[model samples]
Target: MAWFSDAYHFEKSQLTVAHVTDCHLFKDQSGEYFGVNTAEYFARCLAAIAEHQVDCVVFGGDLTQDHSRDSYQLFAKLIADSPLLCPVFWLPGNHDELQEYHAIAGPHILSHKRITFQGGQLLLANSKGATPAGWVKQAHLEELSKGVDDTPSVVFCHHNPLPINGYLDKHLLENGPQLLNALVNTHHCIALFHGHVHHDYKYAFRGLNIYATPASSIQFTKQTTQWQQEDLGPAFRLITLNFDDTHSVQLTTDVVWLNG
Candidate 1:
């Protein structure tokens, strides 16, 4: 609805990004899906976001257990109650329905989008498709390459392009190599961010930073080909970006654990 209000105070020259992922929120807090209180956990994560107070918030998809329209409405209302400076940006995960999300979030909720903020650019690529794992279709790749063609950019999506050290990696973006190739060949992306791994991880891909934020509901421990679920509590990533003409860009990622 583009409800701009004095409540949203933002500094035009710089931006702070808060990233939360894999909420898997449900309608009922007591509803146990995979043995986690999805709704309560998501509420706690939202509270954490309210406390951090960043310029913009990014939800790395799988926002709901199932792609329910009611779920999206609930999410919109939850975020609307927050006083964040910038509008929330959403990327679809394997669990989201792109059409429903667009209907709920608005026309701006495209599968992929290029956003400019504080002299820097962000390219959000949609990885939602019919694939059981992940898919970066040709059209989205082309669109992403175009967005990063000559700008310093950070990429966002739902699937990790790098190895996650588990069976889940099998569902990793099947076409990640092609996507990364497009990014590297285009010379525009400085970093790539994603979810679905449900853990905090960082790796270097073709000289670009590839990072994954932990789930906001529950975290999965890192193991070598082993699946271990832990009550690591809810987590989020608060990232501050500093840019200047003479100095290399500076970035910091802080893990914030929700208390409750």
Candidate 2:
């Protein structure tokens, strides 16, 4: 990860969000990714988040390890059985089949939408492109940028727009610089959140804060040039957004590690 956190953030908020990403699930419920049962871990994650009274949940993509229809079906079933009562939103990751995922997914995935909360709204940028690397079309970028203005806002996607200077750096969003510039230009943008690096990362560019939530499946080693996984449990990011009548938002973040 390119950034650091000296201490955990806060304890209370108006709009609380749980961001779960990089599930890498399989068709079989007992499937594992590097010894971690992806499906079970994801279920554990949802169970843990259910305790928090979150206003919404954002699945940051890569729902399937094998990109199979059965995998997506399992994903749909899990959420259907999940105790989480909040609104759910999702986007495509590098491994996600952008072209066929919608049809293949038993429960149709929603189109690009916003998660509106008390103070402002959350925008999703589709960074899924031609390969493992990310690419957002100029038209879509412009559309996403238009939503952020004087109102406090946050952006979510699947790829890290900036590199973490590790093996994942090679898979950084291809046109990420432009994407960053688009969001940066939105002075009211509060932060950008994503997954794909498989590690918790925090970054700031041109005053726009960014974060990468840990995967619900496996955790990756940070700051290493080589590929590696850490002995860690399934996890997700808890974002507490406190807003004022002035339409500005204050955010505090914490990652909830499950006992999987």
Candidate 3:
């Protein structure tokens, strides 16, 4: 429940961040999951991200499929060998084990949980609890509440704080209402980002924008009552935060598909 503060000043008018999630990587590069070659797709997504010139990269979780030490090692190696060239921060998704991920990506881990860029801050909280579903601990909520200040901020977590309907809703954050209530009271949070649904989604709740990025390996069929895969290729999100003269921040997000 400690907040790690890493602050940086950017001269640019806007800060560019690449959001990649749900990699579901395996130890073997050739291993496939749900008919998708996750390692291959993740590599392609990383290549796409390299071209963006992002200031930083934020991983929205589900970093592994097998939850093995090798899986975490492979992920760390891929990122180390990639050309993204920026600070990478990651949170654990439902499919990920924190200890295993932290053991490998210790330096790059998002456990410190907050990053400052220009006039805005990106606050990441762990929503993974004792179950596959999401739950925000009271300590995390208190940390978030205390972290808010005059700067505009966006929160990132592994689970959707709000339901997306169908099968996904069943596993949505059980205490999402409490989380939302805490956020709404902050008055400085502009948006929220999450993974796990494996599909792209955008909505507004209590005046805060809620975004869900597609999985880097596979996408789930939307509006389905049961588990099903979508035919869509892997994708990632590029988010740009612009600051006005009043220090008000505006965000624009674009989902990039790696089909080629």
Candidate 2: lDDT of 109?
A: 38
Which residue pairs in candidate 1 collide? none
Off by over 4 Å in 3: 5-13, 106-111
Give the per-residue lDDT of model 1 (tens digit) for 80-113: 6544435677778888876766766642222325
Backbone clash pairs for candidate 3 read none
Residue-wise lDDT of candidate 3 within 12-116, one digit each (tens)?
Answer: 768888899999988888878898988888888888898998888889998888877788888887877777677788887888887886687545444546777
Per-residue C-alpha lDDT of model 2 across residues 74-185, encoded as one tens digit per residue:
8878877888776566778988875545554333234435766566777777888888988988878877777665667788989888888878889889888798888888
Q: Cα lDDT of all candidates, in order?
A: 0.72, 0.80, 0.82
Candidates ranked, most accurate by lDDT first: 3, 2, 1
Say which prediction, candidate 2 or candidate 3, comes out ahead on TM-score: 3
Report the lDDT of model 1 for residue 109. 26
Which residue segments of model 2 deviate by more than 4 Å? 1-13, 98-112
Ranking of candidates on TM-score, top first = 3, 2, 1
Query: Candidate 1: deviation at residue 207, Å?
Result: 1.4
How much lDDT does candidate 1 score? 0.72
Cand. 3 TM to true fold: 0.94
